[model samples]
Target: MIKPIIRLLLIAALLAPGSAFADTEYARVQFCWAMGKFDHTIYFGEVENREDRQASFDDLLEISGIDHHAVKCNTSDSTSHRLARAKLLKDWRDSEFEIVNTTFLSDLDY
Candidate 1:
């Protein structure tokens, strides 16, 4: 009975569109790989929900910390892409904490 219920839940998740990505916002920004440099200027105006994009951008800023805490990006381009990881939690317990996956993109290939 438990197996059947678990299977049904998995099926439901797969059938739901936008369910996983509903609150998962994306942004296009200039980025460099971990240990790399940030001298490029990529655009980030193609994301959806322009009215609410700023909030997402702010979230990204906190995740990357701009010139502070940042993780390795997921893209090979390095000049134009998306952040590989993010941590939205303002406060988390030491034992309950986990590293947010990091990813990014750029355009100039620099």
Candidate 2:
């Protein structure tokens, strides 16, 4: 019983940090998607609500404490292309967190 408890504690210790790191990575990917959207909006001369987008990005950066320079946005692609890529990234990011959460919860027998 003591050995089983030790093993469980070790497993929890190992998985705890990984979950936090995965959350940070998810936030980083979200920031990257916002960056892509910002670039795409500006690339097409859509300045009507540009300030709003900028504010949203700024808010996210401030809240997440993530460096804006960490992720570079691709400006070579057309706005539509960028939007499509952003959609794919969003889907991947969402699915990844879902899997991580499910696995983590299952591993803990929760």
Candidate 3:
């Protein structure tokens, strides 16, 4: 009984610090867009919490072949919203892909 308890405590001690550190080191990225006819916007983003798992924005651009400098929109609406968008943009900018223009085509049922 005593040996099992000691082993459990040791394991917990070794893993506790790593779990806490991981929680702090992870970062989140999101992609959001609005489509006509839908009540809410569509969003897709990645959360990169690990150093090795984080994808460079430049790589994303190269793969997609997009220019990042052409994006021109006021993404700053609120503090929380701004921060979330910034994180996504940072990843995109790092990959060298810029948003040019976003147009939404309406699909209303007549």
| Stretches of model 3 off by over 4 angstroms after superposition | 1-31, 34-77, 103-110
TM-score of each: 0.20, 0.23, 0.24
Error of 2 at 71 (Å): 2.5
Cα lDDT computed for each candidate against the true fold: 0.28, 0.28, 0.30
Candidate 2: tens digits of C-alpha lDDT, residues 1-110: 33532542343343233222322222211112222222221111111111123344344444544333222222122333334445534443543222111111111211
Error (Å) of candidate 3 at residue 73 is: 16
Task: Give the Å error, residue 75, model 2.
Answer: 1.0
Residue pairs clashing, model 2: none
Worst window of 10 by summed lDDT in candidate 3: 101-110
Ranking by TM-score: 3, 2, 1
Q: Best candidate, lDDT-wise?
A: 3
Total colliding residue pairs, candidate 2: 0
Off by over 4 Å in 2: 1-31, 34-59, 63-69, 79-87, 90-94, 98-110
